[model samples]
Target: MTQVNRPQPPVRIQSSRVAESIAADLRQRILRGTYPEGPLPKQDDLILEYGVSGPSLREALRILEAEGLITVRRGKVGGAYIHPPNWSSAAYALGLAMQGQSVRVHDLAMAIRELEPRCAESCAEREDRLETVVPALEKNIEASEDALGDGAHFTEVSRTFHDVFVDLAANQTLRLVVRSLVAVWTIQEQAWADAMEGEGRYPDIEQQKAVLKAHRAITRLVARGDRNKVGKIATEHLAATQPRVLQFCGDRTIDASSATAMRGFRGLK
Candidate 1:
């Protein structure tokens, strides 16, 4: 009996692997602000720079595009425009994940109930509350007040107050996380408002005024750096408001693909 050994052939690199490598490099550059001023180097230029085949380069760009990092345009004006990651993108991603899990409106509302109060507390703990948080919140409160009597409009304005309040939190991580949840919740709640308004069942003017008053009181507490009081008030405010939206939502799952939800992102930044 004779034993034979076969020589191993050279392994070919997969286009996906090459694309991933290129995507990794470009992703870091995008995050690092390497191409801050304009679209990324042209495809030809990137191809030359990376010394890869056109398909590999294109695949790499696709990868970045899918990650919400680059926007690939077409025709003469076509180039891969850089979009460094931000809160809205994070929120969209989070929404997708929640949607995939069939996360319900009430689940999101409950999670918001737990997380958003912490954001308010963080805002109150900021040393420059007067210069930063208070004014923004007060401005939003004024807008909310002005929109009173218009149910849908008032809902929109009041939601902005929460968005602004969360954005003012000093912790970047907490700000982003809470803001993402709020963004999702805002879409859901605003949809509820629009529907209820259409049905002539949206909250009354007095209820809207109560919401504005709560916002104003939260702002004052944030101004005084009353962290505990502001957090408590925020918790109470959310408790009072979320149920209406939740009742409309019932057991409905979070909708990441709703046309209304997609439109909502345009106003996020």
Candidate 2:
């Protein structure tokens, strides 16, 4: 067999304080559309703009590169380029931000379960207008085929299924909130998966099939405009995963005082 190189681990930021400030500035510019999807300023220019030294600027660039906000290259075309943040990227970033402010992983999961079924119920109401649900349901099934033996893949597909429902709901504000919540939860779930992978404690392969079956049943009810059954089945589908998430977070305690203290570190009250 041909030799394969090990993938390099992501570089760590030596100065989080500097990196975070730079990241905040860059994030604002991007959000404001000042830095559209195009080339970015030279390092020296950014150094002057942010009023930071070379090392601090480079460190910030490294952090943004890791966060998928900017791309750095070398030679004639070398410089950081603005990257348009997608829903997935936004979600992960939001997750990191929330976790930094002490939002627990399982608590995030509970929040999703609370919102998603209602979105599903909405999809059921306008099933004629929405076409994404059935295919998303199918994808959920195919994605779960080997979930018992592959936790990472399973988690990704599961995330997709939940995200699709959020999309199908057709509410821009709700979609934005869901993506923000998912982003924070994704990091926690990744951490959770690391410890739980292959412990033979995952939901069985058949259990996943049942969830998909429920999804399809809900789709059918939605197609028939049976909002009541849609609501009921959506509840059942989500309840399937809620208990496991609760169990995972059972031992992870959060003190309200600590939460309050952390809240002071966040942007909003």
Candidate 3:
């Protein structure tokens, strides 16, 4: 795969919107061990803390839930409880929202170009830390190699490899954005993988190898603190892989700008 180079400043102009702020505060608290895996702070406590109403507090909790931070229970035992959030549900919501969106391979390429440099830059900053992310990347690479003959296994490992970037980026907002996009891409890619499975080419070991190689190279770049090189490699690697993905899937039918349609359909956003 030909590596393409794109560079971005480390800073991103993230929104300080109300919900985002509430979400950020709560995420910080959770990360700092304020919540842990116990019952969440009572709604009244949260309402008092934030000077918000029951509805607003509930909305904040919803964001937490969407991010996989808390489990809201009903019945006598039910209230919000702190737990690690999984990205899968959010990813699926993104997948459903993108289900009918009009997307071309090039549109996918364009979106990636916009987002990846930021991820690369962030990952590069944390690359040397190696406390959480780099090991996870390597682990997924190893897992992929072992799972090459299994279609279901390969799909999962591939997703994990990409997800490592989201974690490394370390920006909650960007993590959410890329995760949602990955969910949609996964759906499209899965379709292709399924088709390939039918032709006795179910396991594309070579494709996995290419993707793994790209990841390993990027990891090395990040470890070296070469932000420019990392960003370039990320863009090039992502863009070059489009044809490989498209070979297994078709263009998306719905554009993300019409995401409101998903809300109407689900009665939730």
Candidate 4:
């Protein structure tokens, strides 16, 4: 038999392991709301707390900062501050990967099609749907009406309605993923708006009215806790609304302008 050798993955250095361990410990404390002790502790204090070298402690803090869990400041007065997790960051990161993949406007539509309607189902399934979900969605509808014919205002409000619709689903993980999807789609919406450039900005009045009507009906279904009905209605509504925006996409690839808008989505989300 001929001798053969198998390649193995590179070993993890001990220093990297120590830094990761410290980062994990700090992340757990932050999530559990047990750290910071009023003001973010000094580096010296953290070094003692983790019993790690200064370099290892600094590396761990850098890791947390990259994960969007903490913000580090540089000054006599500056200390690390805990930042709540942001889906915008996740969405913005996903957008970069999407740009590389030549993702299409239809891809965005499919994502929203699967996600936002399930959110409606979640609202319907919730025990407190009447007291919580119904009122918020009603508010969204009312505001949408107020913004009618005002392209910019209506666009923002409608986005909020979609965001809250998913948010009301009561699953944090689902809310995070869907919220990021919503953020990504907003890039496509802006691309269409820019394509409109000097042409008619807002959709036809009847089209806008139809949107508001569908939202109202979905909210009603949610109030009644009709899960199947809410899900079906929402899926149909988003599917119907998508083609109107697909008209503006360029070659199934995010154009330079739209890609720029996508990169800036963190601020919007």
Which numbered prediction scores highest in lDDT against the true structure? 1
Overall local distance difference test of candidate 1? 0.88
TM-score of 2: 0.62
Residues 13-76, candidate 1, lDDT per residue (tens digit)? 5778888999999999888888894699888988999999999999899999988898999998
For model 2, the run of ten residues with the poorest summed lDDT: 260-269
Kindly list the per-residue Cα lDDT of model 2 for residues 1-269, writing each as its tens digit.
99999987555444567778988888788878996689887789888888877888888788888877888899997888887776655554565566467766566667777777777777666645346666665666567565645665676556566666667776877777776665455444544555576575666667666756775677667667676777777777767765665677634532223343234223210
Comparing 2 and 4 on TM-score, the stronger one: 4
Total residue pair clashes for candidate 3: 13
Writing each residue's lDDT as its tens digit, candidate 3 over 202-227 gives 64667767777887898777777787
lDDT assessment of candidate 2: 0.65
lDDT for position 81 in model 3: 88
After TM-score superposition, the amount by which residue 191's alpha carbon in candidate 1 deviates from its true location, in angstroms, is 0.6
- Which is the winner by lDDT between candidate 1 and candidate 3? 1
* TM-score, one value per model: 0.93, 0.62, 0.59, 0.80
Query: Model 1: residues >4 Å from true position, as ranges?
Result: 1-13
The candidate, 2 or 3, that scores higher on TM-score is: 2
Order the numbered candidates by lDDT, best leading.
1, 4, 3, 2
Q: Give the better candidate number (2 or 4) by lDDT.
A: 4
What C-alpha lDDT values do all the predictions have? Answer: 0.88, 0.65, 0.68, 0.78
